[model samples]
Target chain A: MNQARRGRPRDAQVDERVLRTAAGLLLERGYNGLSIDEVAERAGVAKTTLYRRWPTKDHLAVAVVARLQDDDGIDDTGDIRRDLTDYMEKIADALNRMRSAGRTAGRDDRSAGVVAELVAAGARHDDIGEMGRQVYARRNALALGLIERARLRGELRADLDAAVLLDQLAGALYYRVLVTGAPVDRAYAERLVAAALDGAMNRKEIPPCP
Target chain B: MNQARRGRPRDAQVDERVLRTAAGLLLERGYNGLSIDEVAERAGVAKTTLYRRWPTKDHLAVAVVARLQDDDGIDDTGDIRRDLTDYMEKIADALNRMRSAGRTAGRDDRSAGVVAELVAAGARHDDIGEMGRQVYARRNALALGLIERARLRGELRADLDAAVLLDQLAGALYYRVLVTGAPVDRAYAERLVAAALDGAMNRKEIPPCP
Candidate 1:
């Protein structure tokens, strides 16, 4: 019920100022520290002006996260292996840029803050949770495309669901973010691709499609 | 050296009180919000006395986590597969406990605060960041024992490294946790045991060791 209504009229410059400031505070102090007052102050605007557009902190944060730059599309090189490699590298590159952006611009905390609360909010999007699935859905779409191509080429199991494979791949990245401080670097990316492409069996043969 | 030195006689009872209070605080507020004053108050002891034992918050938190009890040694029925199932089941039980515990005790900003800090500290303890790895190590140790038996029975490839196999088995669990939020339940544990026992590649035809 507290979701911010979109499309409030504003000075383009002022709207841009508010967004950039909110994004900055998210990275700096995280969700608990972010406030409407701070966003208004950072934007050098009136509190009434900020409240006129957004209804809740969750809505504001989600909007900011929704606006984050993510991988638009995977570059397909035709060769399956090379395409996967390129895809991983691009994803890895995006991940690194996000990390660095988090560190320098005080943005990472806000990004993660939104993710944690949204996910914890479960299906309750009204209370600061609408943005939870956007990033994950984007990842599944990209990876499913890769796996679907591989399945067509007879490189993977016909029975293996693209959804499952995508889950395994994205899951590793989320796991790294949550539990391990491990970087999603090119090498690790390559290893994950290898594990997905070829099961961790020591045998050189790929599993015959079921 | 801000490290506290108990200049007098070392009392094991005092150390026990310190650990118990620290553990309670850790489970409640986590590392960041947990303070020396609170721990002492909960333990019904003086702050100076708690300080004399812990010295720093990081040191105190580590000690508290380290002291928490772990499982009874695994039940190995001499079959690696069954042994792994039971072992992972124990782990699943623990994770279920933590998931609930994390949620119920989810007050205090420590969800991000403590987990982030402690995971980053990456300090070597038998129990800290080793949360996921410990369960794997125990399972792998059982698998190594199983693989050797399988080799004698002519069921395992000669070139297989037990350590690598163990990593993949556990890596699968980590993958699931990261992606699907799937519990390492009885079913998942069985799948892991099977995949590890029989290669993900149709093991009936038996791919040769690479």
Candidate 2:
């Protein structure tokens, strides 16, 4: 990290320091409170330089997400079930971290406004859309692989669509995080995955009971 | 609607015009763009009067939501699947209307920043966080009742946590509307409800290969 920071003396395209400072403030002050002058002052750069690259707060907001999302690479484990559990639990952890961070940044000031900013940022895609897609796709692919492997082993039903099923379970987490701001721990992840995979599945095609 | 449009008597403590005009403008300018003076001018009321009633723009935003929400109600089909599907589809429809309205106001920005502000108003309530919770609880309880009814009919697992299951499916709509800005229709709602109720649900209990 230090090496990367020191070695970036040549380029002046997008201000990495400004981006980092802005992200920190955003995670702290939230979307409504962020300003170009604060970011430039924090990064020791001119406001003109910041504005030249990012015309609007929306554009800079996207850039901050893009920079932070670089860490969202795919993780593969040989055991699909364990891997899936860990992957989902990690998502919960990430959410907890973000929520806590936002809280520290005064998100509690007005109906989780800071977190709402993050949600809005996640809403649309400029350049960061691809990054967000990649992160979610990796998650989906992991679930798909687990279900496929289970199917091959005669575990899951042949007809189950892992893609859609994965969404059913994962979408639950999104709700929990966004609405309730609840804890996304391993225990919760395991239960949800197990329920989604075993308990609720009805391959016998039972009728809609009256 | 026409009768109420008639001119009000002089010296009315509450200038209804300001509130009405602000609400109309909210759907037009969104939360981020609408201002206090504009609302006053539109309503032809004193700016001081507007401030006296709603201390902040956030407060007015909440009032606006309360008004609109009063105009909306849930669908009670008595069938769990159909009812939930209809309810979710209605939510998606509302989101669509809000999106269209936002576009009309913002020209290019299709966000419910206005709505989000209103939702934020319910973030913390001394009594019970009554604002957003009442809205969500009512919606949740309605769905939970449907799921419980299904369970009582022996259609779903006796041990199924219906609340979590509902969250799993409904969360998809919220995520789509809140994050992806995607159009969720009856088809999507049906698919989600089906998956939660009768699709592959167990992840840990691997079926033994014959």
Candidate 3:
């Protein structure tokens, strides 16, 4: 093993280089314009090396998004509201970045952009779909842990569904981008977190239970 | 106008026939297998007639989904919780139908199926994207009206952000289908609505608000 690895570059460094290069192409030219060959050439890596790592453009694109999600890790500050809002904003920022990919700087582009392409990529290929789900699962695990901590500390209801809470918070941002063609900014993220934390029912009056 | 309408079958009838036939093909063959030529042949309509209406396969697919959404209209029975839960269930059912399309029944299929393709179609074409947004806008209008009436009757908070609330309910379902690969069913829909309505806070104890 030592002899085989002696002359080779570090795998982590090579992966970072290729992923950064691929991400640039994906954002600059959009999904259709992101070519495997171009990413290899731009990253100054061998085509075989890139191909061995990512068999298709979809795999490479999914990897880039997975890394972006990884970078937007959860920060537990004990204040569930603020922490949740901050996490939502980070997610919103990442989504907004992808939403604006390949579009003009200031134009009101309602297109889902690379975000839709990645979702479709997950749909098209089984391995890519499994990989994407794994990334979300890991990210969600961290967020769920934060929620659980709050619940245990009496910050949240003992009966709170942590999965659904995370779903509502993150889902609103995605729903805006993919379904409503709406912009997701920090303000919107705050609103979403607030709505989810504080139920819509008027506390003074009995809720409509029928 | 009278001359242009000369006995070429009622426009509404032709539209209904075409959309129904197209939706069948889409669900049966999935997005990739849905062919305009086959739809024209199966629907017993001229290719020009279909083209004059939809223009492209993406347009036709979008129209099919729009019709499906319209058919799944809101049910406002004065009780916002039940109403929202029912609405979420409908949306979940529709998503599940599309999620299982063209796949073997009773298999553990985690794929998003045709739903993802339709979303990608919207991103690929501006007209499709606008059409989809209009469809959701009209549907959301009905839901917002329900929330407004509930608020007027003291069922909900006076200053509640109805848009954010709706986004939370509907977004969670879509987030499950598109991102998490989780099954969205009636029980889960009930849980989601319950959480959104009651919130995650332990009101007896002060929430962890900074």
Candidate 4:
């Protein structure tokens, strides 16, 4: 039970410094190379302080990634297609960045790299898994809100499954990175949004799903 | 490289016996509990023989899951929606089964379980990752073929991006299991297929994306 306790009084500056130092080491050295002792030394913090905060390397790694995801805020431009595409691109860019961590700089590696370890970290620790779900739940709520607003504006169907739609848009990027080893980018995001918004069925005289 | 070379002579009976024994241990013992020595001993095969075949515990685990996936044959019932729903259910069923591994029976655990380790296994080894991609490639080709048949029959758009469609369908399931800790089942699959087939956009006068 190495979960970080909520509402623990802490120095904001120290927290930020530790995270910055940890993130740099993670990206520069990969997950296997990340060491708590090294991070403490580099950040000029006591080892006990970092351990008390993060507990384990997995916890530290998940925190580093959770912070990155928090910055990818969704934008609303009234156009569902365009807005969704922009959001998907932000996610893809983040995934690509994480996928590049710990690999040879110019090798063009297709592996999930640190991204896979983050997912595994969730599986390994129940608290990390809960934290990850919480992180995504917050982000998903925003995306769902965007979809709900569009539905209200008559831009989408009245019965649109916003959750499933979000899953499709975000899921495809993860599927490519984690499962299929495929590339995800702006062009792919456009194609994914188009397929999801317009659908595959021939719309000529085809009635929508009941 | 820990890769099982292609065209290498293998005893079909021994492979099946070893895989069945290994699968039992994996489901009962979980990923961390799985050991190569124990598998070789329990399967009554020489340690050298098992090592020559699987090379590592991760390879053995991947092989076990790959065999399970091989049984999920896609049935082209001609209705793309119905067929896709059925295919998705099979995937969800497999995911659920793996999600329950190494946990108390009927405990309703939301973690990804062995599935997460399998994904990490691929990330840890390039050979396993390539093997995983090949497995998905074969299965995806069949699903893509099903989508292609619908498109050819005027049931879907002529310019449908089959690959993205498949990604959306399968990706959502994996995303629920791996990222969100959300439940994936038959009912959700129905909603997913419906959303993917018909789309979220209001279709009265909206032109499809070019």
Instruction: Report the number of clashing residue pairs per model.
Output: 1, 8, 0, 0
> How do all models score by TM-score?
0.59, 0.71, 0.92, 0.92
- DockQ of all candidates, in order? 0.13, 0.30, 0.56, 0.54
C-alpha RMSD of each candidate structure in angstroms: 8.4, 6.6, 4.6, 5.2
Write down the lDDT of every candidate, Cα atoms only: 0.54, 0.61, 0.89, 0.89
Between the candidate structures 2 and 3, which one is better when assessed by TM-score?
3
Colliding pairs, model 2: A196-B201, A196-B202, A197-B201, A197-B202, A197-B203, A198-B201, A198-B202, A198-B203
Q: Among all windows of ten consecutive residues in candidate 2 chain A, which has the lowest summed lDDT?
A: A105-114
How does residue A116 of candidate 4 score in lDDT?
A: 92
After superposition, the stretches of candidate 3 with alpha carbons farther than 4 Å from their true spots are A1-9, A105-107, A205-210, B1-9, B105-107, B205-210
lDDT of 2: 0.61
Pitting candidate 1 against candidate 2, the one with the higher DockQ is 2
Q: Candidate 1: where are CA atoms >4 Å away? A: A1-63, A69-71, A75-87, A98-130, A161-164, A202-210, B1-17, B20-45, B51-62, B69-88, B102-184, B191-210
Lowest lDDT 10-residue stretch of candidate 3 chain A: A1-10
Instruction: List the per-model TM-score of the A chain.
Output: 0.64, 0.67, 0.90, 0.90
Q: Estimate how well candidate 2 is docked, as a DockQ score.
A: 0.30
lDDT of 4 by residue, A1-210 (tens): 122654533566677788899889989888898999999999999999999999999998888888878878999999999999999999999988888887884545668888899899998889999899999998998999999999999999998989999999999999999999999999999999999999888878644555
Query: Can you write out model 4's per-residue Cα lDDT over B1-210, one digit (the tens) per residue?
Result: 122654433577688889999999988878888998998899899999999989999999999988888878999888898999999999999998888887874645778888899888898899999899888998998899999999999888999999999999999999999999899999999999999999889968644555
